[model samples]
Target: MTPDSPASIRPAELAGLDLLASAVVLVDSGGHIVYVNAAAENLLESSLKALARQQLAALFAMPQELEHIVAQAREHKFSDVRQELALERAGREALHVHIIASAMDRPDGAVLIELREIVQQMKQDREERLLDQSQVNKELIRNLAHEIKNPLGGIRGAAQLLEMELPPLHLTQLREYTQVIIKEADRLQTLVDRLLAPHRRPHIVGDVNIHEVLERVRSLILAEFPLGLTIRRDYDASLPEFRGDKEQLIQAVLNIAHNAAHALAARIEQGDAEIVFRTRVARQMTLAKVRYQLALDLHIIDNGPGIPSQIRDRIFYPLVSGRDGGSGLGLTLAQTFVQQHMGVIECESRPGLTDFRILLPLP
Candidate 1:
């Protein structure tokens, strides 16, 4: 049996290794693959037979760096701990992995390589940050709403008293001034109430079909912007129903689609604006530190001039807006509602395309 060939290794030698989630490789002193587990085969994107005879350099674009690591493992008394480094995959994109190289106890001078992707940890870290930030935002909004709520009633009542005390007939022209104050106060009260709605409102859960929610939002948007907008659907009919508040889902999607519609004013006038509602299934997804076997991906795409780079990052924050005279609470409330369902809303925008992706776990 060739010392470099791992297929000749006894089945007992492979025990417990196959069960590992991360890819593991066993190579001879010359760095010839003697054994590769199922995870390794998937990671390498090659069949067992093809991977068996592969060299470390053939597998990774940057073998010289890995070769140095293996050399350290052999020469040093203490084996090297797993370190995060970039490994090239199939002459394509770089794959980030935490790798460990240790010399095997036997005289064959083989080294065992263990690798796990670092990107998964990064994704989990990002989700945690977003969740923590969302909580902080909610607390800030609630506090601000309470502060504004107290002063608004006083302002509106004071304006009324001032108007009534004015010379009744002589001040008719100035009555318009008090009316403006009252009207503006009412408008602001409405805005503050909306800012507080997502927190104060109770979530009423029921069976929800995302397509139905999108359809409701689509019709509502079209009715409002009847002349200049076209809303398209790209749905997966096979998606199963989940428990959620249908009305809240409708409102969340509506807020996003409505904003997209309004942003398309120029395109609408040119009669070429488009908004697409896309749905698909994502497998083995993780959100909020929870690993889900499947997730529902819903993307709201717009062909408008895209979100302004300045406000893109803060669009989900209350009172942050990109347009003139915009209330800016639409996306904030939408985010709050989606978060209630344990989902996340993310956006990618450029010159012509703006895609809002909502990811929700599937039960």
Candidate 2:
């Protein structure tokens, strides 16, 4: 149907069409919502009649990027598809939305915009990027393990052999130098082993209950840091089993929980440390470009001095850590393992609370 024929269409037909679809809103050049479909009403949690003549910006906190999208649509008659944006719904829940807008062919100058939840889209994007990076990481790890590790082993052996041939006084200094080489070689070898572990190990896929993994991590953390710490679980019993490598999932969850435990040390000592493991089922989840009806949502939350701002962005990168004694491989390994199961890991942190979210597709 032509956009200009709004007057010719019956109100029932328009409302019915909107209710059957996702979210649809028609706004004038002045940013006023001239017409909102039933889906838009439900999505915004506002009635269509009430939304009429109200400024679109008044309904939600529009991100600068989304404002730019609206501006472009008005200025250049731009149309967008699958443009990711964030919106705060009426109930104050921050929603990730994909905004599609097109200039409506009307003399009154209106734009038709559609909103779809973009959490799934973002998950799929992350999964695809991680999977691609995983393949490259696998190759790099294999090459380094074979090429550098083999030569380093030979060098360490040669150092030990040469150390036995030195004179008494010279032997002490020679042994010291040889020991340094061997120690450094050993450290490198350990690093190589970590890098190749995921690829070298066979994935034993099974029905994994996320709660079991969380509980195991909780016990381990409490045992190590048996102070004033509290661990809580908030799991949705209705969540279905997901197919994954059990050992890998355990390691992945443990790594994140361990990081939280470390972050909570001060709070734990003060008897205020709280770490929560929450699980939910996400509907209409999309991972690696494929959509599914259900996905697992696992959140690891901690109340502590939050992650440092400087290292926050690179927390998932290898060798990056916020703590002094941390190996910096926990989050990296956690991310790697989750990605292998076609999942996405994300973090949100502030001064008091830090949350790590793991989204995995369920069978």
Highest-TM-score candidate: 1
lDDT tens per residue, model 2, 193-291: 887787788889888888888888888989998889999889899987778898899999899988888888888879989999999987655665565
Off by over 4 Å in 1: 1-57, 70-86, 89-125, 164-174
Error (Å) of candidate 1 at residue 174 is: 4.5
Residue clash pairs of candidate 1 = 6-34
lDDT of each: 0.84, 0.78
Per-residue lDDT tens digits for candidate 1, residues 182-207, read 99999989998998999889999998
TM-score of each: 0.80, 0.71
User: Where in model 2 is the C-alpha error above 4 Å?
Assistant: 1-42, 46-113, 116-147, 167-177
Please report the candidate that would top lDDT against the real structure: 1
